[model samples]
Target: MRTLAPVALAAFACVAPCAANPALDALVAAYPDHLAGYESNDLIFRDGTRLPIDDGVKGKSFEQLLDAPDIKDQFAIPYPLGTANLRQPAFNEDPGRIRNQAMFVKMYGDCRKGEVKAQMKAVPWLPSRGGGTVMVTTANGVADQLAKVSRDLEQLPKEMTQYMVPSSGTFNCRVIAGTKRLSVHAYGAAIDLNAKFGDYWQWSKPKGGTLAWKNRIPLEIVEVFERHGFIWGGKWYHYDSFHFEYRPELIALARQGWPK
Candidate 1:
């Protein structure tokens, strides 16, 4: 998820309240190692920091939501799991965007300051496919979950191996393109599968028009990642088919039951 410019934050004068919901519950359950619980309007961290879930603003435009979002904004788009059949998301309906900066910085230290690297551990990808090891954050058992993902992918048919080999790269401490927000990769909690099979919105979008949803990655591969708590970027409206990031909260909620 990327951050919007500061100018975007200045537009909203108040934010709406954040009531307890399935999304919040999934968030609390997903990161038991860090989150304690959530209140009517604030999320209480294990360290007892009271973070405001909503910024008290309402009626934000799609661009505004992308530029400046509170915790609740992250759930504005309900992430659809187990399938890739859907229309293009309403503008800016990026389910995984709108990450709370404070919460993430607290859970996974700031990589720009070298805090994230200290906790990173390497996990071997598809060895048979010539995939070398990639480093992921050890915090919140992310490394362990990714290892499971690798093992599952190894069992796939040989033809699918093409998309499993030669990973793009991981654990780069860089901002997302054209945004001030830190990429999930910076936290060592994300991975990019084969770039050859990848399809990105920027690359697929028609001139002067909307983003066309296109994907070549198989559902079998997507399901494997979701089983281990990773969310595929292909699921996003602004799709990036090769990208997958650790976000078990969304998966757990979808599996157990999503609140209507």
Candidate 2:
């Protein structure tokens, strides 16, 4: 929610050719409904709003990156795709965590204003196991894509139901545990599985600035979600093993091996 100074805006505008940015290309490709394309250093939305790609802040602290980021910052850390290749990310290597709040609010609508629930669609989560319906947004066909994920998840062995059945939540109008920043759940595009089997960074405090990463969510389940464009929170340095959110742009960037 930080405003750009006029001088900063003029200086950073269009420093590189628009075509040279694969990140921007991936973003437009991921969500065609909200974004039209990129021009110079601005992201052109379908509504004709040209948002600045950079906020003119250099060497941002991790907190700054999460709370105040421009459109381009969303792609600053390339997401690692698939379980076979993902590593225990180095400190603060949270790829899809750095979201461009302005861009997201533009697409998903602000939940605080009652804008997000209006777009909700009830999706049957693992109907085969009698898992009840969950509400999610229809934006960018998220509900449809989740249906596809459900089809794949339900096919897994019945024992897996213990980990998946009774989804923790989907749409919640709230901020992240300690930050002013809104959670993806606020947009109704994120899902949390059975919390009983999930591990969150905040749930267990890190010691001496080092986080001992842990996970109970099976890699098989992670792969299923990744295949359909949802990024796993377990991949983060501050991991959340039971969280999955629809972030196709991050998934698209990972597929291209993320331009260095």
The lDDT of each candidate is: 0.80, 0.86
Best prediction by lDDT: 2
**Model 1 clash tally, residue pairs:** 8
TM-score for candidate 2, please give it. Answer: 0.92
Reference-based TM-score of each model: 0.88, 0.92
Per-residue lDDT of 260 in model 1: 66
Q: Which stretches of candidate 2 lie over 4 Å from their true place?
A: 1-17
Clashing pairs in 2: none
Off by over 4 Å in 1: 1-20, 84-91
> What lDDT tens digits, residue by residue, belong to model 1 across residues 218-254?
8899999999999888877788889999988888877
Q: Estimate, for each residue in 1-260, the C-alpha lDDT of model 2 and write its tens digit.
A: 12344444333322344455778777777887777666666786666688898878899888889889888778778888888766788999998999988888899999999999899999999998988899999998899999999999998988889888889999999999889899999999999999999999988877897898988988889999989989999999999999999999889888888876
